[model samples]
Target: MNFVEELRWRGMLHDIMPGTEEELNKHMTSGYIGFDPTADSLHVGHLTQIMTLIHFQRAGHKPVALVGGATGMVGDPSGKSAERNLLSEDVLNHNVKCLEDQLKKFLDFNSGPNSAEMVNNYDWFKNFTFLDFIRDVGKHLTVNYMMAKDSVKKRLEGETGMSFTEFSYQLVQGYDFYYLWKEKNCQVQMGGSDQWGNIVTGTELIRRKAAGNAFAITTQLIKKADGTKFGKTESGAVWLDPAKTSPYKFYQFWLNTTDSDAKSWIRIFTLKSQAEIEELEKEHDLAPHLRILQKALAEEITVRTHSFDALQTALKTSDFLFGNGSLEFLNSLSKEDVLEVFEGLPQFTISKDEFSAGINATDLLAEKTTVFPSKGEARKMISGGGVSINKEKIADPALILNTENLINGKFLVAQKGKKNYFLIMAE
Candidate 1:
């Protein structure tokens, strides 16, 4: 269970300080990765760092999950092109607590010797005065040294000059490492490739301030094979919170990974052994149309991030929508669950009074709603056996629908062909 080797084999290793591997191998060293509370819920982009910590702990080392309550206020400028709007204390506190709860799900916090622990920088930085920080932290790094960082250098060259607050962000974050090192005996700091400069600053602070050695390692930043940003869809980031991004959508996000991206992500995201992944890849190659790789990746991740039950529901919903299962499955689901399953599909609303009176199927699809452009077109599709309501084929153009036809008494699931889906909501 060599941590460095594990990351290397998975193509996750990006930057490692000299002797980092030796330090990790020598003993059960304590290591940590910091997460900022920039949002109430973490997105898929944070999964890599979460996986890094998981691997660190799996290798029989103490893993610490640090929440950047203090640094979050200042905001890390690592990959940002411009300044960000600051969050208030109440909002930031809420976000920190939310993120802490999410991180706890990925690691074993109860195991004895090498158990995971959560720490908040705000706990210490809350009472520290600016003057004290300048004397203790700012004194360790020179302005020239700080300005040399790529994050700082880039901001200086841009029209919107970097602010003093952002410039000192690295120093604030470095102190967090120093504090953890001095207090928790955390030996190594890990993060995404973009945080290399900030991480090194911490190690340097340890050496120059206390003549102590600290190690750094960074994993590759996840990106799409198409060169677009990872973890983002047209709606925005794919959030970890089921409330923000439903389990179905979250599952679909990974299920939709491109073949090339799946080849790489399967290694980084899943804890499957090399032999197991290789076997899956071989099977996937045999039938690319089956999307075995995408399915494996999605199932593993969805189960871990959400739950086995969630994965089952996502699968059942997928099966029903894709035409592999019957409408009875939809009928078996609760009204809320049914709506969740068809979240992204087209939906139309009709007055409850109009719906109770029972409308003609053709009128419902053509006039009352827009499932088809015209009554004639709707009739033709119905005749061709290409249309369905509540999972049953529309038998006649004049067939009536009303409250009795509504699943859970509020909705009707309409299907056009095998793929196109529409939801008719009666309120």
Candidate 2:
């Protein structure tokens, strides 16, 4: 597979230094992309770079994933309006380990000749003294050259102004490339287009310091068709970690994408072939309401980011909440999973003793919980066959709900109509 051609067809290629494609075509070259350990978990915003590395490895080249432990402490000023709060060494260490674990899920580290490798910038920077860094790296790049970077110039123009720590981040990042080139024979650096300046600085460092040739390639920064940020929702960023963002929510995030974004994102995020994607697009066009494209994108990405079982659970969860799915699925869930399934719904707690003794359906929905505004409304809804408990219709307003109705021995799922849901917890 041609690496540059793959990126280009997927609309991922943004900028490529001269001869980058020619160099890649000549032989299996090693390249690296730096990931900052600012968070314990990588969000969907980082998927572009992750996909880049995946493609790099798929093209039979060595892919080096550089986790920025030392540089993370200084914080990159690129695309930032203010200086970030620096994390402690311990926190940065934890984040780096977490990132490594996540990256392993997508890249093969055991393949011979062109396997992926993980590196920490701190491994080299930890022993190098500040004086040594200044003399060896700092002296190579002039202040004018560093200041010429868009990342630096924008910060200098910002209201808060840039800090010295952030100001020197390009130099630190540039040195990372130099060290990798010298030690690991990594020839190329890849990242989002915003990092073009930092990446060029690295190539320039290799030239000035060792007279070595290096290359740079950057992918497009993804954004929504509406011009808002990608990977963000009403709740927050959709994270790769299931603990931070539930598999169900993660699935919904992709499944709910606009038709336009889904068409573009499927190419960039999934490993589906061009022919297969074109087929899916034809089917989607025939039935836009079916959201064929969105489902394909969501299913492929969710299973890759998580697991097949997780995708199944997310599908069942969606059905249970939105369609006529069974209670058996809910019964199989843990307490935490159950809560996650009903995460933004209204919830109310009732006494365990009261629930054991049994409460009238109208009373349960009205006085005990706010599923209804009043008993009259609850009775009205129940009489109209618009209320359900545990996926069963309430036949009579005076129907009794006891401990037997509890799902997983602690909760009741309530539905006001076809859509609105509520959680009744017995404690």
Candidate 3:
């Protein structure tokens, strides 16, 4: 497999330095992409680059994942209007560790000749003093050259203005490339389109510092078809960490993509071959309402990011909430998992004493909780077969609910209709 061609077909190729493909084609070269530890978990925004590295390894090259522990502290000014608040060394260390662990799940580290390797820039920069960096590295690139870069130029034009710390980020990042090229024999650096300028800085640094030839490749920055930001929802970023964004929510995020976005994202994000994708596209077109493309994209990505078990749980959660899934599925979940399934739905709490003593359905829905506005409304809805408790229809408005009705021993799942749901918790 040709790495560059793989990215090209996926619409992931943004900019490539000349001869990068030829260099990659000549032999199994070492390549790397730097991931800044701005957050503990990588969001969907980072997946394009991750996919780039995955293709790189599949093409029989060594892949290096560089966690920007050193550069993260300084903060890259690329695509940012203002300087960022720096994380403490301790926090940065924790983030770097987390990022490393996450990256491990995606790439094979034990594969023989061309195994994936993780590196931290902090290892080299920690002991290197400011005087050492400026004298040895800073002199190679002139101030004019640095200011000419779009990232620096944009900040210079902005009202907030760039800081010395951020301005020197490219130099730090460049040094990282030069160091990797010299020590690890890593011949290529890849990233998002925004990193084109910074990536070139690395190539230039290698050229001037060691008279060595290095290459750069950048993938397209993902964007939604509607022009809204990708990887974000009403809650915020869709994180890879299951703790931050539950597996069910993460699955739903991809499952809910617009048709046009799913059509494009499937190519960029999934490892499905061109033939398989074409077939899926055909199947999707046959029944657009079924959301076949979105389901395929969501399931593969969710399973890869989390696990097959997690994907099953997410699917079961979806079925329970949206389809005719059984109570056994809900009963199987832990308290945390149950809460995760009910996230973003309306919830109310009633005393355990009152719940144990048994309350009438109308009273429970109207007085004890706000599932209904009033007893009359609750009775009307119940009598009309519009209300359900624990997945069973409430046949009579006066039906008594007690400890026996509590799911997982502490909660009742109330459905106002086919769609709206409420969680009534016994405190």
Candidate 1 lDDT over residue span 166-230, tens digit each: 99999988898899999999999999999999999999999999999999999999999989999
Task: Please list the residue runs of candidate 3 whose C-alpha ends up more than 4 Å from where it truly belongs after superposition.
Answer: none
Positional deviation of 379 in candidate 3, in angstroms?
3.2
TM-scores, one per candidate: 0.97, 0.97, 0.98
How well is each residue in 1-427 modelled by candidate 3, as lDDT tens digits?
A: 5888899988999999999999989999999999999899898898888888888999999999999999999999999988899999999999999999999999999999999999999999999999999999999999998999999999999899988999999999999999999999999999999999999999999999889999999888999998999998998998999989999999999999999999999999899999999999999999999999999999999988999999999999999999999999988988888889998889888888998899999998899889888889999999999999998898799999999899888899999999999998898
Candidate 2: which stretches are off by over 4 Å?
Answer: none
Determine which window of 10 residues in candidate 3 has minimal summed lDDT. 1-10
Provide the lowest-lDDT 10-residue window in model 1: 322-331
- RMSD, one per candidate, in order: 1.3, 1.2, 1.2
- Residue 46 of model 1: what lDDT? 96
User: CA lDDT, every prediction?
Assistant: 0.93, 0.94, 0.93
* TM-score for candidate 2: 0.97
Q: After superposition, how far is residue 214 of candidate 3 from its true place, in Å?
A: 0.5
lDDT (10s digit) by residue, model 2, range 1-427? 5999999999999999999999999999999999999999999999999999999999989999999999999999999989999999899999999999998998999999999999999999989999999999989989999999888888888799998999999999999999999999999999999999999999999999999999999999999999999999988889999999989999999999999999999999999999999999999999999999999999999999999999999999999998779999988888888988988779888989998899998988898878888999899899999988888888699998899989977999999889899999999
